[model samples]
Target: MSKLRVGVIGCGSIAQFRHLPEYAASQEVELVAVCDIVEDRVKEIANKYGAKAFTDYKELISSGEVDAVSVCTPNYLHAPISIEALNNGLHVLCEKPMATSQEEADAMIQAAQKNDKKLMIAHNQRFVRSHQLARQLIESGEIGKIYSFRTAFGHPGPEGWSVDGKDSWFFVKEKAYIGAMGDLGVHKTDLLRYLLGEEIVEVGAFIETTAKEFADVDDTAVCALKTESGIIGTLAASWSYTAKEDNSTIIYGEKAIIRLEDNPAYSLVVQYTNGETVNYELGKIQSNDEGGQQTTHVINHFVSAVVENKEPLITGEEGMKSLAVILAAIKSNETKTIAKVFE
Candidate 1:
């Protein structure tokens, strides 16, 4: 098959460090165009990669210069750009939080289905080796009958990682939609659901803008989630882990307790009910503060799916289900009540 020509919209941090570089590295992909409001950013990236540069995403989409595009724009633009690309007969690997609302997410999914194009969400947590291994152990009854779990994804905040730092769109309410919940929370929400292989049916949460007083969005959020199988868990998303980043999960089961990325020394550790223990060093989990790039596997997976005419692991529907948990948590926070997911 011919190389899949690709364009990337949004020259932000994720685009600069993840999408653009990954596409450039993929032999099966041709990095054909780049779009961002910041003209200089796109020009530099385009020149470096020998791709067309555009300030307007609409122009990039209609330029007939690419077969697919990565929607790495801010949260608000995710659904719109992806829908436009899908409708224009191009595949889309959209960045996470996928959309600010379920209505928009639904539209994106519909557009891809109607156009017969691929729409993959960039939820990279599921691609981590430790996470994949953890899921397998649970499925194989290594950790029999998962009873509960606690997962968290936290860091100092987007200020250090964002291209514009303190004044970046990440801290803007209108552009970002939600802060930590959408930024970090949705990842754990998606990861937990994937590992448990269950749909989160209900949620109640306490979300607050405790840190980053300059920001209007929530900086800390704690959610109580209950799955369809009656398994319950807690999820914490925060931008206030001042000292260090914490991206880990602990699952309790009848047979054993599985720990993922919780220990710096070990990627995954299993403790059995019979006082037996096992440890595995899978690989490193991607980090924003590491000042280095780890192949997220998200780009590779999406590219292969599009090229092979196969369904991706995290499709629009799967993205929506994950986003629903956060959306429900938001609703629950406002109403001070438990919210039923997918209602």
Candidate 2:
């Protein structure tokens, strides 16, 4: 089969570190075009990848130079760009938090269904080797029934990771919508659901802008969540962990306690109630702070889904469900009460 031509929208940090490199590395993909509002950044990326650069996403989408696109833009543009690309009969791999609202997310799903195009969301947490193994263990009843979990994703902040640093769109409400919750929290929400095989049903949260100067959005958020299967847990997302990142999850089960990314060297560790222990060294989990040559398994999965004509592991509907949890948490914070997740 011919290589799948690809265009990437937004030549930002994620595009630079994850999308572009992964797509370029894939034998099934041809990086044909790139779009970003910043001319210099777009030019640099396009030149590096030997692709055309555009300042406008619409032009890139309509140029007919690619078969699929990776939307790495701000949260607000995710839905519109993805819907447009799907309407134009192009498969879309969108960055997370699918959209700022459920309505936008629904519209995106509708567009993909209407156009019969694949719409995959970049919830990279689901692709982590440790996370995949955790799901397997849980499914195989090795952990028995999961009773609770505590998952956190905290870092120094996006300023250090985004192309524009502190002045990036991540700090702006109109562009980003939600801060740490959308940026980091939604990832854990998705992963927990994937690992537990349950949908988050309710949320109680305290989301505040306690840190990060000049940022109008929340810099810290702690959510109390309950899944459909009666599992309860705490989900914390923060940009205030200036000392170091804390991207870890601990699952409490009937038979054992499963720890993920808790220890520096071990990716997963299980402590059984019978005083038995199992350690797994599945390498490090990829992080925005520690930018390295790590395989997220996102770009390759997207490319394969398109090439092999299979549904992506993280589909539009699944993405929307995860987005709903964050949205519900946001509402929980605003109302100072438990919020029910939208179905």
Candidate 3:
């Protein structure tokens, strides 16, 4: 079978570390082009992979050298690049927080639908082995009814992860639109929805700009969220975890409690009401730390979806649902009240 030619429309940390590398390693896709506003960065990445480089994403999209694209750009550019790619008749694999707002997300979805192309969001949490297993356990009634959950995705900020370091657009309110909440919080929102197989209906949050002096956006956010099924939970996101990363999730269920990415020895642990305990060595969740899981399941899954001519596991509409929850949380923080997620 002829491989799908892919262009990654951002040479940032995510593209360098996850999307580009994963595309090169895939058997079903070819890394054919790369784009970034920084010419040097794009050229460097493209040279490394023997792919074409473009400073402007629009040029790359119109180059017609790629069958698909990975929108690894910053928060604000997600919708624009993705919608452009979809309208150009290319499948899109966009990074998390698919858009800065619900309207943009809706536009991206509409573009994909109008073009009859697949648009997958890179919510890698749903692809984590422990998360997948946890979803299965919950679906099979192993954990019984879930009462609550607390899932956090905290790290030492984008300075440590982005290629541009502290100067990354993640610290800019204009470019990023939101801080850690948009960067990390959206992942947990999507994860919780996936694991519970329900939509987050409401969110209340306390978002603050207390950590980085260089950032104009909130560096920390703690939110209270409720699923459509009446499950309540807390979601925390921070760029102030200066020492280390904390990516953990704990779900409280009636028959058993499911703990994910909490223990280094075991990625998942479950304790039953009958005093039975099961530990699963599903491996650590993906992180920027050295020796962490090297490959992201996002690129592979996207390739498979395009190759099989099927919709991805996380569609633009699903991504829009997750983004709606985050937007509600932001609204809740601004208004100091619970905000219902817009359907």
lDDT of 3 by residue, 86-126 (tens): 98999999998899988899899999999999999999888
lDDT of 2 by residue, 136-176 (tens): 99999999999999999999899988889999999999999
What value of lDDT does candidate 3 attain over all alpha carbons?
0.90
**TM-score for each of the candidates:** 0.99, 0.98, 0.97
Q: TM-score order of candidates, best first?
A: 1, 2, 3
Please give the clash total of every predicted structure, in order: 0, 0, 0
- In model 3, which runs have C-alpha deviations exceeding 4 angstroms? 291-293
Local accuracy by lDDT, each model:
0.94, 0.93, 0.90
What stretches of model 1 exceed 4 Å from their correct place? none
Model 1 global lDDT (CA atoms, 0 to 1) = 0.94
The TM-score between candidate 2 and the true structure equals 0.98
What range of 10 consecutive residues in model 1 has the weakest lDDT sum?
A: 283-292
Residue 320 Cα positional deviation in candidate 1, in Å, after optimal superposition: 0.3
